[model samples]
Target: MKIDGSTVLVTGANRGIGRALVSAFLARGARRVHAAARNPAALEPVVAEAPDRVLPLALDLTVPATIDAAAQAASDVTLLVNNAGTHAVGHLLDMDLGAVEDVMRTNCLGTLRVLRAFVPVLERNGGGAVANVISIGAFGGTPSLGGYPASKAALHLMTQAVRADLAPRGIAVHAVFPGPVDTDMLDYVARNEPAFGDFPRAPVAEVAAAVLDGLEAGEEDIFPDAFAAEVGRVWRADPKAVERRLSGIT
Candidate 1:
């Protein structure tokens, strides 16, 4: 769906790619943007950009009640952006189980909860679009990512299934796979793991712009960065090769 004049809602809109998306949407002529975050206070700067068009809502994906409330409040939303996610750094077998579960809960189950609540809202608004901020990790596993990749892999399948189901209803479901982004999330990885300190990271604004461009072009699977595009092509050619490369097992 076109961003022009669309009423958009974005989750995790406090910082990183989420914040960038909110700005991009407004720049692209979105009529209104509901920026949802666990801490609505963190969204003040984004809301200030367009006081009349930006609505800051308290939404915690981990909280089902909040998701329902957001769905109710943002009923006129024509585009839904699921961008909240968590990550744990460690091997799956060696990482703290609690951390792994937290990643799964937020990245997988939490996303699902948001989708369930908003599907009806979108339908009521005459069938809008849903864009899920997935990751390149969804295609394979990395020894340092722990359960983050697994959760994203699950989300990938869910995106596809939901796309098929929603297509009949005129609701478009799109998945955006972005490689490492220059955000606080990547800063954490660089600080904790020196090995990835020099990894190429895409600018948050660039990635966000690509996502909006893809949506307008009717692309269902969007690679929003150069790294993501290359990785996606490799994986499509040979999944095992990409898996091996990610695992550092080649």
Candidate 2:
């Protein structure tokens, strides 16, 4: 999909990869970008830089009302990026059931809701693209991260399902799998657990650039980071070997 002149909507745009995506999209000459975050005020810098091209929108994907409002606010969008995600960092058995539900609600259900709400808008705009920012964890188990991997796994499957469902309507769905990005999400884990500090982390800009490149190339599965691409290859080669590698990553 041609990013230049396309209208794009990026969720969780306040920080991390989402913030990078907003800047990258603008740099690529998007006509307009709807920067949606739980706290809309956090997108001040983004809006300041591209006031005429950026729309700061308040959105909590878990809440249907907020999703509705965000969709209405970004009705002109032709490209959609689902970047918001929740991670429950503990054993599922030991973790609160509510936290697990939150992960599922935000990462999977919320993404689907946004896509459903925007399909018509994308259709109206002449069938653009939808990019789902998934994670390498989706391809293999990361027991230490608790329900995070399971949630991503669901998103992985959902990405394919969405591609199948939206293809007929001219909407293209792309799944992006990034490994250990240098974002606040990784910091959150590192701060709480020292073991997470050792994982390799790539800058957000690099991952965002790869995703945009993948979109331009019409790739169905985008592995923006090298580690993630290797993980995919290993996964296809030997699932057990990939699992061992993930487990070994402190």
Candidate 3:
């Protein structure tokens, strides 16, 4: 759907790709944007950019009540961006079970909650689009991040299933797979874990712009960067091989 003059609700809008998306939407002439994050105060700088157009809301992914509240507050939303997610740092065997669970809880279950709450709002508003910020790693090949890839892969499957479910309802669900972007999340990973230090990163603004472009073009699956597009090609060529490689099975 076109972003111009459309109302959008973006989760995790305080930082990273979410913040870039908020700015990109404003640049593309979005009428109104609800920038929802865990702490609304963190969005003050964002609101300062376009006071009349941007509104900040409190939405903690772990808190279902807050998600429902945001949906209630952003009643005019025509587009929903599920961009909030957490990365649990560790390998599968050594990571604490709770940490791995947190990754799944935030990336998958939390996003599902947002989808459930805002889907009806979209339908009521005459149908719009839902952009799910998935990961290129979901298609498989990240050395670290504990259960992060697994969580995203699960979310990818869910996105496909939900797309089918929403097809009849006129609500389009788009899965966005982005490779390393130069964001705080990536910075932390690069600094703490040497594995990702040399990984190529696309600029946040460019990736954000690509996301909007893909949405307007009605692309069902969007690889917002060259690396992600390459990953998509590799995944498409041999899905089973990618799976086996990711699983460390020869």
Top candidate (TM-score) = 1
Model 1, span 177-243: residue lDDT tens: 9998999988987787677687798999999999999999999999999999999999889999889
lDDT score, candidate 1, position 19: 98
- The parts of candidate 2 lying over 4 Å away from their true place are 248-250
Q: How would you encode candidate 2's per-residue C-alpha lDDT over 90-204 as one tens digit per residue?
A: 7677778888888888898988898888888889878999999999888667666777888888999999998999999999999999988998789988887678898889899
Q: What is candidate 1's local distance difference test score?
A: 0.93
TM-score of each: 0.98, 0.96, 0.96
Clashes of each: 0, 0, 0
Q: By descending TM-score, how would the candidates be arranged?
A: 1, 2, 3
lDDT score at residue 138, model 2, on the 0-100 scale = 82
Cα displacement (angstroms), candidate 3, residue 183, comes to 0.7
Judged by whole-model lDDT over C-alpha atoms, candidate 2 comes out at: 0.88
* Runs in model 1 lying further than 4 Å from the true structure: none
Name every residue pair that clashes in candidate 2: none
How would you encode candidate 3's per-residue C-alpha lDDT over 164-196 as one tens digit per residue?
Answer: 999899999999999899998888878777767
